[model samples]
Target: MTEPERLRADAVRNRAAILRATEELLAHHHPQQISMEQVAAAAGVGKGTVFHRFGSRHGLMRALMQERAQDLQTAITGGPPPLGEGAPPRARLLAFLGAMVELVARNKGLLAALGPAPVATAPEQEPREEHPVYRAWHGHLSRLIHQQRPDLDDDMLAHVLLATVHSEPILNALEHGAADRLERTLRDLVSGLMPEG
Candidate 1:
């Protein structure tokens, strides 16, 4: 391959390594405590490389979130069935919520770190509404709600539903091994919103 091609391959590998290292660190350490230097050391890359690639801690967290949520995004866009394209609106909505439950459960630490802070928060923090993953999920949910009940305010309702899954209550349930109950509650909530005829 050409020198440029080799350099591109190296960059890709380095990116993957950095994300993997960040994920591992998030599993054991709070997001606030995991510095760029730590991530660089863990990934076997230079601190400058990490900074150059991600720009800042927030950028790195966002990149990690995108990487983690890529599979769900692909499935939603193109995969089959309720989580994908072929189901009814209510079914699809429920499936999406269920999938999000699992995703949030698995990545609670990272999600908490990336979650929106209060209005008075620092400027560097990204709000949940502005995050790319949140936007995609909100858009999907809003579309599904519109399909089911055009009379409702789908945009606001979408935010409400997303909030249900991302809230402290859901996180606490997952921590307490009450995921089954949590899923049931979510199913009930969605069903209530889009009741069958």
Candidate 2:
């Protein structure tokens, strides 16, 4: 290959190596404890290569989060049953929440190892009405509820149902040995949210 082409290939390899090392390290050690030298060594590349790939530690962390978010979006949109499609709206809603709780549990471990970094709260970026996941979940649930019971306020009901199933609090309870109680409470919550006889 030409010299420039070879150099480009090498850079690609180095970037991949650094990202892999960052993910592995982030899984087990806090980000503050991680250093460019450690990532370079782990990636089997020179320290300078790590810097070239990511300008700083925060940049690397952002890259990691972006990658994780992409992976999660893909899984939720393409993976099995409830997550993808092929279940009743009510059942799928429950399943989606359960799966999300499990995912948060796993991610919490990795995030903890990455240390407590402040997350930017973006209230303005809430999913739009047409976003596929939002539409698929809320629209489908609303349809199902309306089909079975036309009297309920579908929009408000769907929001309340989903809001209660958020994963962070669920993960906290699970970590605190309150998983069984949480499960019972979730069931009660779900039942209460549904249209009454």
Per-residue alpha-carbon lDDT of candidate 2 for residues 1-197, written as tens digits (9 for 90 to 100): 99999999999888878888988887788677888899989999989877877787766765665455455456556777765566655565556555544444445544443332212112454333443444555665566567545788877776665454344565556557664566556556655665334
Off by over 4 Å in 2: 1-13, 113-188, 195-197
Instruction: Write down the TM-score for model 2.
Output: 0.59
Span of 10 residues, lowest total lDDT, candidate 1: 116-125
Q: Candidate 1: how many backbone clashes? A: 0
Q: Candidate 1 — which residues are off by over 4 angstroms?
A: 115-127
Worst 10 residues of 2 by lDDT: 113-122
lDDT of 1 by residue, 1-197 (tens): 99999999999999999999999999899899999999999999999999999999878887887776878999999999889999999999889888877776777677667664211122565666886777888899999999999999999999887776666666767767776777788789878877887
In order, candidate lDDTs are 0.82, 0.61
- Model 1, residue 180: distance off in Å is 3.2
